[model samples]
Target: MQKELNLCWNFGCFYSWSKTLGCNLTMQVQRLESGDFDLRNRQLQFSTFQIINVVRRESIEIGYWTAKQGIFRNLNQDVSAHTYLHPMPDLNPVVWPGQTHIVPKGWQIPTNGKKLQVGVRTSGYPEFMKVERDPVTNAITATGYALDVFEEAIKKLPYAVPYEYVSFDTLGVNYGSYNDFVYQVPLGVYDAAIGDITIRHNRTSYADFTLPYTESGIAMIVPVKDNTNKNTWIFLKPLTGDLWFASIAFLIYTGIVIWLLERRIRNAELTGSFFHQLGTAISFSFFADRERVDGILARLVVAVWVFVLLIITSSYTANLSSMLTVQKLQPTETDVHELLKRGEHVGNGGSSSYVRELLEQLGFERSKIRAYTNPDDFADALDKGSKNGGIAAAIHEVPYIKLFLAKHCKGYTMVGPIYKSEGFGFAFPKRSPLVDDFSRAILKITEADAIIQIEKKWIGDEHACKNDETIISPSSLNFKSFSGLFLVTGVASTSALLITLVMFLYKNKHKMGINIGHDHVQRGHGTELETERIQESTADSNILHRMIQMTTPASKR
Candidate 1:
């Protein structure tokens, strides 16, 4: 025995111990086949001792000694005081001083001993967990996203953890909810619940949840419209109704204003019925042939009005062409709030704890929501919409909804931004030591792309959903986008109109005999010239009289 022990310690050979007279000591090593120069190799261990006394415990005699540590300093020390004792100090090097994670002294967990109990869902959710019956034992075999992630996280742990997945069932009935599945951990029915268990506030009050490894949120899935322009009226789409009305009103207004300024002039082109004048003004916008405007004021109005018409017509042509060539499929409801206001039926995954409460909190009544169990329900909800007794949309966590879309990739799609959630996490009993360990390991697993690998393995083929019918939504021109440019044009036109008005009044002032009188008429101009001047003055005065008559009421006149 001594010879084998010497060889084992020196050359890492097999060794055995046999009973010998007065030789009861046994040695242990820190590691097997350690390098000769390894500092940890300086270890020789003896089984520890614990002396318990049933009666007269204080009178017990105990001697603690080690070649490296030394004997107990106070042999006369009360033995009863050593109820909770530690091994004698040794010369072996202390590892990771102060950084040692003290196992929470409650439960003694064998690092690689007992098989860990993992609870899983048995309803066969593919993205989170899916269980199958083994052909031989008929035992449920678990697999999928959550199972993969759990396995990956365990592998990333510093030590191997033996585990067996047991599906949650009662009397051979499958689990009713993920919440109940999570409760199994706190109930001691499971060491951990491994599935897509959402990290909810209420659940976290009692259960420990690891940091989410998947993105968190609820989103809406709806059927994509097959025809983009099914409900649209094509002709009226070029300009909004409000803009169309305003354009027509301005066209007539330009005609009236121009007639008032030019009607008194001898060479005026406004000598026509009011309808004719309006038609002419409106036609200028369409680039129709027309006579030249007679006066500066008339020309100024025409030029500015024509420029405005050019812009309006150009915008109309471009929009008309787009609406005709492309298609516009606007979403019926873009947000949860909009759906709530419309009282549209909305579907939810069968057993999510937050879906109903979240909708209720957002002000939707409970009856407005429909709960769906599988793909058929989802398809019915979309195929028949709310008015036909089906839901307008189905809302579920993004992961589940993504799986659903991938399978039924033909006409369905997930829409709407996600509402915030904490996501799916591993659940353990509150304050379990594994929580931090699992969370840290999760970071590493995700960083090393193992999570991505697992997800791709399960869902890589699910991306076959492609749709050529995606709506090409044409951006409607809002008034604000063009308001600044229109404002500049408007201001320029008004300034020109005002200048022309001032000049027209100033030039016609003397003809009206308002700025000058007959007493100031030149005497050198004789009878014939005086006659012509009086006749011209009378004619000009008559025009002023007609203008006043047209503007005033009979009582004021």
Candidate 2:
């Protein structure tokens, strides 16, 4: 039986046994153990052999062991000689005869049959191994195999497998379980799951994760001021006191001057004692002086005063009208408590945090809150108010409010402090794979002081108002503030005009050549000269009468 079993063994069993025993078991067993077993068993057999005469019969069946030995011998010689042959008929009845099996000609399989053998020698079976090459590019195409096959292939290799063998679907399942799968999955079915196991979404039970490149916040949107209300009183309030004082002072001074001039002209006696007159007397005489001064000063004062008063009244009236109109026309509730109480119809910009604070977290009615595309629209609606039938209030950043007031010249005033302050940041989907990388880059930027540098590039520090604040020295202020300086300048100008008039009078005095105090003439160098001239004139009259008598002969002698 042992001999028969040994002879029945094929090349596979022979090779396996030889390898396991570390020697050729077939030769050793057949030579030593086979001979000893036969010799030891021959003496114990006692049986009679009977021969019966009968017709000679051809044997239909060959010994199973003998046929198996023939097949094994043929398979062994075929393998050793590298010759292709059909499978043994006796060994496997199902195998088809004369069927040719093809295998890689030049390659050899590993002795250990490891998939990734570095160096080995054996027949390379095509069913277990394959090599593919691109016909056009002549490049090795991807090798397709199972994970175990790949592991085995690299088992005897000098280095471990360089690539990770992960099933994206498996990973995806694990990740989905971990994160609760909040992420919108990309299109396509995965053979294996893939993802970082650490990420998870607690609230939604989703596996949404951020890429290393993702950031935490939205991009900073710069606040812009609409110029619709640019010239409004809200913007002018900073200088309101100065403008009001200047306007009122001008009107008062002009009115007073008109009153004083009228008073001076109307009362002739009062003009001489202008400084001594009673205030009441001066005031009463101003209008009464009209008749005495031919009504010129009175009419002029009345007209001037009327014009100035109109100007002052008109300016004040316009301001009051604007305030009242704005207050009445505003669609939103004007009072803060009213607005808070009527909290419906809140509007904010899309990216504003005020919306988050007021409408979302504060439990305000979100349906009533509308988000504006631009802050300008929000401000416009707010300024329009409930008169136009709009939202109650617009909550926005203080800086934006200031900017709007500055640019639009609108009269809308900021009524409250900053609701909250938040640092601006960039935002992305949490499932983005780039989150870590982006975070690292952000860290690096902070470490390198690049964030500060970038901030400086976009926005500088708050500017100082050098000209807005009074920087004048005390001496300069004193000079500018001196009331006497204006009075002196006026007096000096008046005195110069008076002096010019006096000089002009002196120059023109010769044209009339009159001295009021002098009579016709004194006609004297001395008393003697006067007596002589008188005697001479008397003698000349006597001589003139004789000459006239002598010459009168022609007509009237």
Worst 10 residues of 1 by lDDT: 1-10
Across 285-389, the per-residue lDDT of candidate 2 in tens digits comes to 224344433334344444444454454456556654454334221212334345446664556654443334455665666676666655467666665553465
Compared with the true structure, model 2 gives a TM-score of 0.23
Q: Per-residue lDDT of 404-515 in model 1, one digit per residue for the tens?
A: 7666776787775459888789998988888998999998987886876876776655445555556566655545545554565455546655776787788788667853
After superposition on all C-alphas, the RMSD of every candidate to the true structure, in Å, is 16.5, 28.0
Misplaced by over 4 Å in model 2 are 1-338, 347-357, 360-557
Point to the candidate with the largest TM-score: 1
Per-prediction TM-score: 0.63, 0.23
- lDDT (Cα) of model 2: 0.36
Cα deviation of 353, candidate 2, in Å: 10
